[model samples]
Target: MLYSKQKVAKAVLVLIFFTVVLIGITLVSLNNGRNGTRSLRSFVSEDTSTSPESIDEALQYFIYGAKYLLAAVKSTVSDNSANITAVSHSITVVKDRMQMLLSEFEHHLHRTEILSFLSLPVINNHNFSYIYNREDICSKKAVKLVFVVPSAPGNVEKRQTVRKGSRGDYVRKNANNTILLFFLGKPSPGSNYLSLQTKIDEEVKEFGDIIQADFEDVYSNNRLKSVSMLRWISTYCSTAKFVIRADDDVNITTVEVVSALERAAETLSNFIIGHKLIADRPSRNVKNKYYLSKKEYPPPTFPPYLLGGLLVYPVSTAKLLYQAALRVKPIWLEDVYITGICATKVYIPILSDPGVVFQHRKS
Candidate 1:
């Protein structure tokens, strides 16, 4: 008879529990026997004048207790062996069923051509007209790093000044190997935001390193921003060895980031490095800004994700993650959607490091 997956899973858990209990019991019993034997030897040695009958009685008691304990353990082992066999069979059935289901899912995805978005049309407002397109670095010379900074439209001048004052020297020193691009979205329509837009346009023309995608600049649209950034990177700056996605407020020097990247260069491919959040649950309070409704995400716990404020990935990993994002349904939480769910699909390893701090600091 076929067993349901739930039943099979329960049986496997039972088998594991029994195995642990059996091992624990065996260890405890062995320790007790050793202590008992030591005590008996000590008693005999200390009481040299003790009668043989007394010693024999004590030995008999010990042996009898040991025999009873051993018999009980043997019975348990026998019963557990039968249970383990049955549980193993159930596990095998479950594994087969899971494999069949996975195959069917893959077939369905292929039939729907869900993974065939290699030629996705560039979103309307995604054209990088005034980009600081460094053709020289994009060619035969290897670009070592690319910094993708997500910035608010209003913070253009402040961010630019901070970048120049703090990280300008480092950028110039590694001019051949490093590039930094600030990503932004259009300000909300109908607001008195034309001045902010004009300022952003002026900066873009002056610096030529800002990428403004077609999307609303809001907290809820960060996931879309992240996806748009990744798609842009995959298309234009795919040759860079490492990519660091960070926020404008983060106070990290280019030197420090490049030093870390250089240290991990040998084994960086398909690896994401950042502070990791493990087993984080969705906030339930409706009033909380981060609250996720049951309809938005039904899972009790989220998969491990890197903090959104700062993340480092090998260029190849960035490409794969972007492709994965195209296939996975996006969640509003950019970090969870792009780095957690999409990264999991591609089996990219997310490594936690304390070096990348996300907290805001004055430059």
Candidate 2:
């Protein structure tokens, strides 16, 4: 079946046109997968007036594009004979852009809502030096107990006195198994306070067990101080088995704390052990120092929380509580906010222990 030359030429031209169209469609699909459906609009709206709805729509498109690109990159990387270097470069660029977009979205949400807690920046310039930072404390031995003592700036002398009088034997006995750190805030700023600063410096030089952050030394900032201390532990002493968040003034029986941790070591990975308060209502009296406004806490009954003066928890529980605190608004009561609310947010259990008593005692 021989055909004329002109007819054969016409058929070849038609085939070429169809092939071009198919290639064009393939390119468009790939571009869409990389930049989403609103890719064109995103570029156009860059210089044009846009509304919130339009920005939201663009965000959705960008998210879709990111997901699609991620899948494509993963698939491409799995192929053994693919151009690995080129694919990796492309993926890095896409990841940077996606991260930038997500950051912008978070900023927008912060502006529109009361999410100040979520925006709390990481504590910077924790001014206190590491007086007794044993980086290998957990690595070298089994750390059964870690006592985090929250102390005031004015209580340095008292702390030293107590350490020498009452805690000396306990410290000596648990030298390898326990760690003790005094948490403090920055000193008051004034010329008259120079002597106090010098005293603190001398004490730190002698003991080297204080952890000071840049926050104010006040009752209301206790929650912040607690969280900051947890952050420090998470950064520096993450391998410890258990922790006791306590006050410098509290009479902590180190023997009791070590025994409890030893007994519960197998079953207590995410539990808080302390004197628990159940079904306690928030105070409403304006004259009371522990007053709670409805705006601050609308819940009728407070979740069961350990007494702030002395609470024991596994290191894992402390880490989870710290993470949840970063996302939740802090209440004035550090015990309720951190152990009850934040722990609840992260699904950590709070258990009552009769041994951890909170009372002032005369040495």
> In TM-score terms, which candidate is top?
1
lDDT of 2 by residue, 28-74 (tens): 34444553354433433453364335444544544554556556555
The true-versus-predicted C-alpha distance at residue 27 of model 1, in Å, is: 23
List where candidate 2 sits over 4 angstroms from the true fold.
1-144, 165-168, 190-192
Per-prediction CA RMSD (Å):
17.7, 20.5
- Residue range 209-295, candidate 1, lDDT tens digits: 778876778999888778777877778778777788878877765556666655544423356777799999999999999999899
lDDT measured at residue 101 in model 1 versus the true structure, 0 to 100: 28
- What's each prediction's TM-score? 0.62, 0.60
Report the Cα lDDT for candidate 2: 0.63
Q: Which ten residues in a row have the lowest lDDT in candidate 2?
A: 106-115
lDDT of 1: 0.63
* TM match of model 2 to true structure: 0.60
